[model samples]
Target: MKCHRCGREIPEGDNYMHLGETLCEDCYLDIRMAVKACDPWAVHSATRFREGSGHKGTEGLTDLQKEIYELVKGKGKVRKEEVIENLNLSEQEMQRQLATLRHCELIKGRKEGDKVYLILYR
Candidate 1:
């Protein structure tokens, strides 16, 4: 077969490659190593947020808020900043969501050493 990119004759049993593109083992290794050397945080930042949801259009969280609720479970209390950092939410957004959670009796918040901690009531 011939390499699509370089048009070089690809040897037999070299690599199956991706259909039309006859990517050799060396090329494949280079691509894989390049990917491995890139920052994991950059890769994570690209795909952490799932797309295609009604919640994407709305300010109110759908499952992400519930995810935070579940995370705080078992732990008696957690700091507001910790929740904000872990959940990737802003302080104002977390405060609003916490208020809703409190209204629903799922969590309660109080001042602890000048920092607010939310206690999972459920």
Candidate 2:
């Protein structure tokens, strides 16, 4: 079987059914715990954690997080689809990573006309 969300192949009996859609474990979790970038509490908690942890300015980011940061940094600003295509990331993966980056105040989203773009945080 294949996940309806991410389109990854799943072994028999390993897929989960949600609202009549077959989803993989990752997709299920992602849907259940979707990130909220505008939550002030989360931003405060992440900021406090980073400050106390002595990790500054992407110092303790995972490899993928750093890669995403660098990609945005290099581009100045890029459309959401551009990052998705450049990194070959699923939409869910991109959202998770972008949320982390946003919580760290390392990146932000902007609107120009009808589209949103991601850029390094000022």
Q: What tens-digit string does per-residue lDDT give for candidate 2 at 1-122?
A: 89998899988888888789999988777655444433556656656787898754665566888888888889899887998898899987898888778866888999999999999898
Extract clashing residue pairs from model 2. none
Highest lDDT, which number?
2
**Candidate 2, superposed: residue stretches over 4 Å from native:** 1-56
RMSD to native for every prediction?
17.7, 5.4
Candidate 1: minimum summed lDDT over ten consecutive residues — where? Answer: 52-61
> For candidate 1, what is the TM-score?
0.45
* Backbone-clash count (model 2): 0
Question: What's the true lDDT of residue 18 in model 1?
Answer: 57
